[model samples]
Target: MDHQIQRGTVVLATPWGVAAIFSGVGSQYAGMATRLHQRYAIVRETFTEASDVLGFDVAELCTEPSARERLNLQTESQLALLTTSVAMHRAFERQTAGPAVTHAAGHSLGEYSALCVAGALPFAAALRLVRHRGEAIADVAARLDGGMMWVIGLDTGTVEHLCRLWTEQDVHPVHLSIVDAPRRAAVSGRTADLHSAAGEFEARGAQVFPLRVTGPFHSPLMGPAADQLADFLTGIDLAPPRLPVISGVDARPHPGGPAGARLLADQLVSPVRWHAVQQRLAAEGVGASLEMGPGRVLTFLSAGTRGHPRPWPVDRYEDFDALARAMRLGADDEPAVLDACLRIAVSTPTRRQDTDVAGHYRRLEETRRARKPGAVATGLGALDALLAAKGISARERRGHLAAATGGRTWQ
Candidate 1:
């Protein structure tokens, strides 16, 4: 089937909902997301929110020449990529008025972005978590001598066998880190060991290419970083996702709360099962895949998958319109009505220290009992009225709404 977009429409597409795929590190570049930032108010607001948490101008870092080089560093790169990916997703939602994401996934560091999109983590909390994660990984990389390489034209089984042989014989550790496609994988180990093994992979009819990364991520060598991240995550709160988020670590839906925290922390030392992630998406009945970040790396990976759910990259301004038309998303649709429980939840403050906690809960329960399970109003306009009547300030409205509604305001 033809996967390419022709005249802003996708051909041979399925009827199931879309899967949003967030880009990870190594996808960031100078001036990435500048177009979205310049054109969309939501994008600018996202960057501003990230800056408040990160204590740096993320927009400037992505666009400025001098600051762009900092993206090469793990800490800066991770934060920048997370901010940009989140911003792009928000912009896509507002601009396209598309169907709510049915599922979400990310590659490596992009998992944090996927969690944010799925409403498992608050935006500010995600930024702070990524900052600490980047720092922890950077610290580990500084202490260890490691690298990663891509091995194409070889199945994962063959690559795993080769890695096992090398690890059994060599002093340095070598492990399979990521399986991107059926026959494409990445291996990680000491820098010298990677270079030494490159010849063997090439000799076996596989093309070996070095990746631009600081450390051998997604391997046991990153145990210290995983520990550091686990400690940091314990203090943060995680909520259940509105939509399913496939984990790169295990290619399974994240079990939210403490279990999710453990999975995320352990992911640092776990191989990214991206091939399985794609399979999971297909099994979930995702009709199409949208890359909501700077580069088309995830798009390319999805394209390589056999059958169903064609991939599209929605990084540029025009991409949103193209994909919206192709998928016929939100076309001629009436405004979505909010449920009573969700309206009350949005109006309620998440902070435990808020005044009249018992009163809020009692009112929420009363509203839930009084109203049926669906359709509180013609649209979110009713929710806006409720928020205003409840005296929820404009500044807190977006965060409350996003948290309560899983960032899909249209839903």
Candidate 2:
């Protein structure tokens, strides 16, 4: 399936459902959420709430260039990404009535964002949890001189073999941390060990680049951090997700509550199976995937992969309209007119005396029952007339209609 936005509209070659993918660490920028914070009250409110929980101003950390160094720190970056991603999701829900994603997943620290979006964790609680997680990992990194590196142009088997070989020969342990693509993977270990193995990796026709991370995450060396995180998680309340969230630890739907908590803690010391996660989403028939935060990292990873879902980045203010349209159109195989009517009804504010919600739904059902060729057009026209009668402006109606029809204008 291919999703394209042309002339303020979304065009879909094949209608498939959307999967929401959250951004992880290293995706943060200095002003990633500045526009969002300025435009939406919900976004500002989210930041304020996060500040209350985090003891620092999240908005300032994300927007000021002076805070660049601080934002790059593991704890600060994780908190900023989580807060910004959740704010974006909240704003999206407000604009589109609700998210239209069939499933949700996150990379590395992003799993917390996915769980929050799935309603498994409250926003305040999520903030506190990630803080402790970041602090624990940072403490581990402070004591151990370790780091991670990305290796390209090498298959997974060869990379695994090389890691095993280096660990045995050099007495320095290095492990394959992430398998992002077929020939792209990341390794985690002590800084000296990674530097020592770089020549060997290059000798085997692989390109190596060190990652800007504080610690060698997703390796056995992180076992202490994982243990600390596990203890912290036991005190927090976790609810079952309203939507399925694929875990990076195993690329399977997370079983919420205690089991889900275990997977999250273990994730610190376990390799991220992103390749398997993508495959699982493809197998589930996801048509489009939306990156819900600032960077294009996940978008780039999903690109050019056969049988993978088409990836789109909702990283800017202008991306909301097209994203809403694409999600609305791809939500199901229902008639376009029905979607338009339903969206219009949901987006409109209700009066204090308006208590005929059931009647409104009955009317929607009646419209759905009319399946004739011209009936759809007639129903759409009637809906327009009703909106106009209720004092809806021409511009607002056009926007609503475009959202409903994936940017197609009615004649």
List, residue by residue over 43-143, the lDDT tens digit for candidate 1. 89998998888888988888777886787777888888888888878877888856667889999988999999999999999989998998889899989
Give me the overall lDDT of model 2.
0.77
**Which residue pairs show backbone clashes in model 2?**
none
The lDDT values for all models are: 0.73, 0.77
lDDT of 2 by residue, 62-170 (tens): 9888988987687888999999889988888786543467779999988999999999999999999999999999999899999999999989789988888877786
The lDDT, on a scale of 0 to 1, for candidate 1 is: 0.73
Model 1 steric clash pairs: none
What TM-score fits each model?
A: 0.74, 0.75
Highest lDDT, which number? 2
RMSD (Cα, Å) for all candidates, in order, is 15.1, 12.4
- After the best TM-score superposition of candidate 2, give how far the Cα of residue 373 lies from its true spot, in angstroms: 8.9
